[model samples]
Target: MAHASGMHSLEFKLPDLGEGLTEAEIVRWLVEVGDLVTIDQPVVEVETAKAMVEVPCPYGGVVTARFGEEGTELPVGAPLITVAVGEKQPTAGTGDTGTEGSGNVLVGYGTSEAPARRRRVRRERPVSGASATAGQTGAAGAANGRADAAAAPVDARAAGAAAAVDGQAGGPATEDGPVPVISPLVRRLARQNGLDLRELTGSGPDGLILRADVEDALRTAGRGATAAPAAEAHPRVPQTPGPALAAPGSTTAAPAEVRTPLKGIRGAVADKLARSRREIPDATCWVDADATELMRARTAMNAAGGPKISLLALLARICTAALARFPELNSTVDAEAREVVRFGQVHLGFAAQTDRGLVVPVVRDAHARDAESLTAEFARLTEAGRTGTLTPGDLTGGTFTLNNYGVFGVDGSTPIINHPEAAMLGVGRIVPKPWVHEGELAVRKVVQLSLTFDHRVCDGGVAGGFLRYVADCVEQPAVLLRTL
Candidate 1:
């Protein structure tokens, strides 16, 4: 695997940061070309749709090259860097080579050991030398005695033809040869859609096919291109006509416009909100509650002088108690399985608006935590969100969400339910208002509480019950004592 220069060149690809993420935008590069990096040393920082993460290099060596520059977006398996090591390293976890990699790659991914063996279809014929050479130019080649093969140029049209032939052959074209694919998810997607993988030229490094390539091909076929040749020949689909050109001699000018791409955290929020609106048969119900007693209780707790309890923590405690009384609200609807999935533990998510955008960080096992515990956790997650250090694990797996839009100085809002979660409890700002307390007209603290829930999970009776219980606790604060 050593090249004529006496250094073994190994390509490191962007690892799959879990939670079904497909791509990430490079925020900054930590190392430069010719810099020496140790195994498991962070080499770059990337921002995915979920969170910002620092990606570590698994192999220790001189950085020969870095792939995409900052602000460039790359897919899950695209090449991130190339390292020239003094000795050949065993392909991480594959044991196909002689060197060992630093097993850890990302928070939830590693390369310490080989994966479980999978059944591979054997190719009936030997791969043609041209196709084999093209395959070796990818990340796969670094494992199969072709570490330096990337230096060779690959012909795109010929590789596309070989891929087409391989598709028709019903298996790989060569025995354990390069198919130019690395992700099983990509392969499964192509197979499920009946798309021929070999027909499209990959846009990835060394002609390695990426998920984007398959998606683009699918989009092209959807536009009436039936065959790969047809798709390749007519790649551009006609776009809708824009505003007509100004009259040749007219003094009038077109209006100025500024457009922003909805991406990153903003894009993620948009997609989830749209999906929730489209899929969930959601209903919203609100009620005005006297929060005077709740505010008094919080003030009294602070006066006692333990770690000061947060209003959010008090509200979170109330939410947990209300969920316990009406467990139906703490569930999700599984449309595909035609069932309601109820969780045994409560992973509570609270909406936090940061400089980046709105993010919901979950408090694991919120139901089991006391007010003090919940306060500490809420503070930790809120700080993380503000600094943009929250991880994917911090952002997902919420059975329910508590949205406190009150911080925006709003009195009330009917929040959109977080997708896949059955319900969201919205809290509005508490302010003094006229109230008839105990048969007398007086000023009292009041707040509006709204609950948005998926109708498929429960009827109005259950939703109303849940909301009423929350309001009752907010008005009296003693109703939550029994649950404590």
Candidate 2:
């Protein structure tokens, strides 16, 4: 849609922040309404389930409208902002409207000169008499040198339908035009549930179908009634059949329920942990080890070297060596194929508790890295976790996990395996304890080590061997010398 002043509005939706993230919480807005932005400029900071990221704008122009406020969670493909572009506007320093935006969606992508392609042109159609007047007023404002005029709200369903008719935002043309569904996940969900996309109206911007729409459609179908009526009839019925809520408008006093929606990082963690518990028949074996030698080795290494080696790094090195001895523990089960997939390279993930939630950042090819390199990588990932800067790539593809819960002052825990991975090695706190060493009684720094493995991947023997090797390294640090 173009204004009389030769300016047109382009809606920039939230692009797919990879690793299958569906939504993000708006943490902050970098640009305000009417702010001039160049292509690829960071316009908003959003917190996805995995990390916090600054979403860059692909269009260069005056930001005419801001869509969601800070703290609002929006699905992917939701409209983020509307930019008004004109011949006078800066098109990524070209100052020509003919040049398209810098093809960058996320950070570290795109270029100065993007390929020239026609922008998504909104087909002009009258939604209502009031809509026509609103459009005219907006155009007049632009023509009268008012570049800050807020965009008129487009009837998203109507515009989506129009876009479908024009073959711009649809899939597989039909008599009623193509379905205005862009997300393949949404299509798959609908297909799996035997729901037709054409019958349901989308709640997203531009009438694009979303996963929530499919879920809602399924829920309505299961209930055999419209959502509004069902919701009104049983307003307090819990969806998953937990405790029954108090009757609506009941005079009886009930405890005030403070419900927090599990959506972002918490929701992701919940889903993964639940899946791990549901699928993996896991068993944990723990052993107490005298870690006096390992601690002394770390201190000596730090005293003799340029950089200090973290205790966690030494433990990680031990884990890599242990995994080398028993690769069965460093693998995943292909449930569909019913085969155990062992990895040659060990991508070691360490659990770090952040303000967001529990996150496991993986160090790629950890088996090849020495103690020093492992220390550096662990420090980098730990700092990234603390500052909420760990990317999706940093958080995934782990063949094995090392969780050091000692920082939390916990003795030991049978940690749930990180889903799809075969096993997790948990390290407890090292503290002073009495022990007999070399036929003498003395106090030694003792630590408890636990290995939790999927029972299907390996038997008790393999799991015990892996744990014994790790314990042996902790007890005698010299055992790592052979591997070195």
**Candidate 1 structure quality by residue, lDDT tens digits, 406-431:** 88889888788998999999999999
Q: What does candidate 2's lDDT look like per residue over 1-484, in tens digits?
A: 3343445577788898888888888765666654446677777777777776778788865565677766578799887887765544354434244457766796324555543322333333435677766764764454343223334433332334333222334443222134765343355456545688899999877988766787788776752211211101122333343266657543333324424456566678899999999999999999999999988988899899687888988998999999999989889999999899999999999999875679999999999998889999999998888766788889889999999999899889999999999999999999999999999999999999999999998899999999999999999999999999
Tell me the spans in candidate 2 whose CA falls farther than 4 Å from its real position: 1-4, 88-98, 107-257
Worst 10-residue lDDT window for candidate 2 reads 225-234
Clashing pairs in 1: 89-99, 90-99, 163-198
Top candidate by lDDT:
2
Any idea how many clashes model 1 has? 3
Q: Which stretches of candidate 1 lie over 4 Å from their true place?
A: 1-6, 88-99, 107-255
Query: What lDDT is reached at residue 470 by model 2?
Result: 93
